[model samples]
Target: MISLTNLSYYLGSRALYENASMHIKPGQKIGLIGLNGTGKSTLLRLIMGEYQLDGGTISKAGDVTIGFLNQDLLSYQTDDSILSVAMQAFERQNHLQKRIDGLLHEMEVNYRDELVDKLARAQDEFAALDGYTIQSKAEEILEGLGFSTDDLHQPLRSFSGGWRMRVMLAKLLLQKPSLLMLDEPTNHLDLPSIVWVEKYILNYEGAVIVVSHDREFLDNVVDSIVEVSGAKLNYYSGNYSFYLEEKALRNEIQQGAYENQQAKIRQTERFIERFKAKATKAKQAQSRVKMLEKMDRVDAVIDENARVNFRFNFSTQPGRHILHLDDVTKNYGEKKILTHANARLERGDHVALIGANGRGKSTLLRIIAGTEPTTKGERRLGHNVSFSFYAQHQLESLNVEDNMLEELKSANPTKSEAELRTVLGCFLFSGDDVFKKIKVLSGGEKSRVALAKVLLSQANFLLLDEPTNHLDMQSVNILIQALDQYEGTFVVVSHDRYFVSQIANKIWYIEDEQIKEYPGTYDEYEWWMEERKANPVDTKTAAPQASSNSNGKLADKSEHNNSNGSVNGKKPVSANDEERKEWQRALKKATQQSEEFEQKIAGLEKQIKQLEAEMASPVVVADGKKMQAKTADYQRLKTQLDSVQEQWEDAMLEAEKLEKKLG
Candidate 1:
């Protein structure tokens, strides 16, 4: 547990947090959120002790380990495998195992009784630590984060930067510290991997503090939301969705109060100016002036100037059919992505293209945008259709040598200097930001520049792929709203469900080299999927094409489990009865081992006590040799007792694991 009291932090002259106070309770999961440059990462650093508080105090409970997983990956041995790096989380267990091995070797060489006792004690400590589960836990976490079984044995240095960060994440999760701090954890994860982490955090036993721009992930995982805004930390009792509603209500109330106070102040000042010099009304005017002076000014509910306002401008309108694709097939060597895929889009259609990662979503978008050619496909764009594309790679496509203003001008060469400056200002780039070189800009800043270019292009059609990758939540919402109101037709490849749900009027679901069209919002599509699961169709027959109005029928139903299994329907043949039986057997064995260790420990304790009583007798103390011999026996019994006790503790820990798994 940690508490921040009257915390204050400053970045040069700008105040990040002033008198910001909050408490992170044990096992509480908190989502830290705010606009970009609002010090979400800085607060995590403060909790990690990377930054010294300028004023105030941060108190943490004693011996509470904190696992902080930042974006950077610390260097490791070049030959160390990924699994080995993750297993380093069990440093204590590793050391104890080594000591046990040394004692085992000593016993093998000399066969000393003391050596056996030492080895037993060491083995007990290692088992009590659940040392045997380390490798499995590491592998499980790595796989959950999208690493394959083959990746476990690969050297850590062989992974790319993003994958290396995932390795660090696995290490942090395996550490199982008292407190876990992750900043932008989903930045590199695919949709499925993100879902895995969401479920993992929800089931985690320790405290979690994660900062993420993915609204849906935060909404699903965290119990509380913390907003770092207006140089203060604000607490919300519920998830991100709750925070949004509460924040809006709070702002509305604050605005009303501020307006009322301003009105009263204006009335008092006017009375004072008009009647202060008069004799009859002077007292009332003076009293009003005093009241005005004592009144506490209510701060207006205006966000800081650092906010992005997005609106797309288009050059021309497209025909009724914005885009059409028939017999679309794309292949990379032997691996086929799309096989005779067919889709149609009308004017003003907002479509979301979603599927698992590496499923040709981005490739399809490129093919549609004319950036890439399909292997065997007939694609056509409607007359007067002009589109702009934004991808992850486009963020780096900006000319590093050019400043922000120059880049904007190049994108929209017809726009004058004044017009360009105004556009940049709306995107939250002003004054010196316009002069900032592309090479020196941060990731978020670079994203804003790239987006600004897309907006400035004024294309009637948009082909965007992961447009919200580097943008903060506020920026994402702004884009969502802008796209919602835009007249142009757009096809977006996005993993942000929240953003897609808000902007998309139709869904493009891809699976098994097929692109199926579902007409409805993302939320509606989710509902339809649940209905299909609840009333499953036979795989033996041909699958029915999902109707456009299917979403409307299931839209109002409650959320359902998407996991593969049978509940209210016929039993699924995929159930693993053998695996379940094996797990039960393991649990039973662990419990029996724990009971046996307890009995052995109890017997050792009794023997040690008897030996102590015998050595303490007055008859043995009077005889020097007898006393010395009794003392030696007492020491031997004590050593054996310690070993049994350790064994008992280890068995108990293993039993606990089994109990949880069984439950």
Candidate 2:
């Protein structure tokens, strides 16, 4: 729907985009990605016409509508309820509703035919526009973005900045513009909300251009990738994973070309140097020199991946048991965060504490660090267990007047200046960058500095809270590598799935006011969670217990059961056999019913699509009677589709329950 050709933009003397060209086709999902300061957000503003382009043109269809969700919307405040704010997207319907209200009020006094006709026309138009269901649609989008139904009626000004950003996102989604641009949309969302948004974007009919550092989110939603690098917009035909492989191959080819070019130049220069003194070959040498000078040079590939070369070591090794929480009960006033929660951390445990927002992940991390007191619990640390807590607020603890090098020195006075500088360089702060004052650094820069100090603290146990916030993909990789190499135990709270998957060997989540542990990698954990969802059981009564296998690793108790109705070594009784047969029959019946319903739902959906197309035909539109008749048929098919979908859902749930019971 929009095309940018030979675009050039500059910030004073620095060129952000030079002759960059990109075409956004209709119904395309594009993920715009780059390291910080590569002009991703600036490009969004350039598209939105907030900034004047120095050169080239950005052309769009005259009727193309655009909706942009950016960080700037965080400052928007109003006394209207969030529901009302979201429903404001239906401008025409809202205005018509107001006029209808005015006409109806006039009818109470005058009762004229004109007023009655106006009200009838307005009502007809409202029904045709689906104005009556606008509020319900707004509410659905808002709730899908993580707002509770009760919170929808609250004043927009009462919410926090992140929540307000979600409200703006909901409003934009409701508007359903032809082209949507979102800047770091996942930054304000939790894991569940992010998943919801991914599904929504996958089914969205309009074009989408999203700027994000979230790899999994991009991989799941976008059909194409756009990399803003070296003042050019580079296109990739696939998602983030494909882009990584493709970029690596391209870099290999470029590096080889660059090397061959350099070698040729060196050989030519040597020839000129050796032959220029001889009178016979001087003319030939001059020609060779000119040829070398006129040759187009190949640009060397710049490696952007930052590596963590410095080893993270602790002064003292902790005991096998690093920490233990026994019957931990934590509360904030009337809110119960944790109730009788028990967990243990060993010296080698690499745990990821994850859940939705406001589930006490950070609070639990602080409690583990012994910085926050519990309502009723005992938190104990093992021998030689030195712990360091890292949180966003720790950035504020840094002395603003001190330079980065000085800050690291303050964190550990014993480390030599060379050692400190080496650590800083690993964090992408090289040479004179260490001399910059902390006050002048950006949020991501400050985060890197804080992370560097945390690594230098020489603590055997680390409690990290949202450590990946404000970090780019490369910086997150650096932190992941550093954590992977560290010999100490750590528990981190982060929403970045890629980082968590890279660093964590164990997963921890809060459910039913208690900490639950899953002993596996993130990918395995996700598979297990999906299986659990498909075969859901009552978690309160049938929680899976961890058991040790022959390899001495933790495995689920269900894995220990034998195939022939035996657990451990005992066989089931005759009564149990009859019960199993009954369950088997029930499962078979349920599966059959579910399959039948799915087929019916598919048929109804197909009929609905056909009716919709028929109703939209020019022949039907030209004849009012035919158009009305087709619309009625379309509505009838739509109602049938809805009913069939509900029944299919019920059948699926029933089949799942039966499967769970049989298992």
lDDT of 1 by residue, 1-663 (tens): 799999999999989989999999999999999878889989999988999998889999997899998865544436789999888888998899889888877777789888888888888888889988888888999999988898899998887666888888998999889999998877777777888998999999999999998999999999999988889899998998898889889999999999999998888898899999999999999999889888899999986434334455664435455776766889998888988676677777889988766688888898888777646877887655788899878887899999999999988898888888877776667788899899999888898888779878889888888888778876786677667767788989888888888999888866667677777888988887778778887522212342221221332111222245432112322336786677668878877876886677667667767876787799988999998998888778667755655565556546644554344
lDDT of 1 at 569: 19
Q: Rate the local accuracy (lDDT) of all candidates.
A: 0.80, 0.85
lDDT of 1 at 397: 86
Q: Assess candidate 2 and give its TM-score to the true structure.
A: 0.80
**Could you say which candidate leads in TM-score?**
2
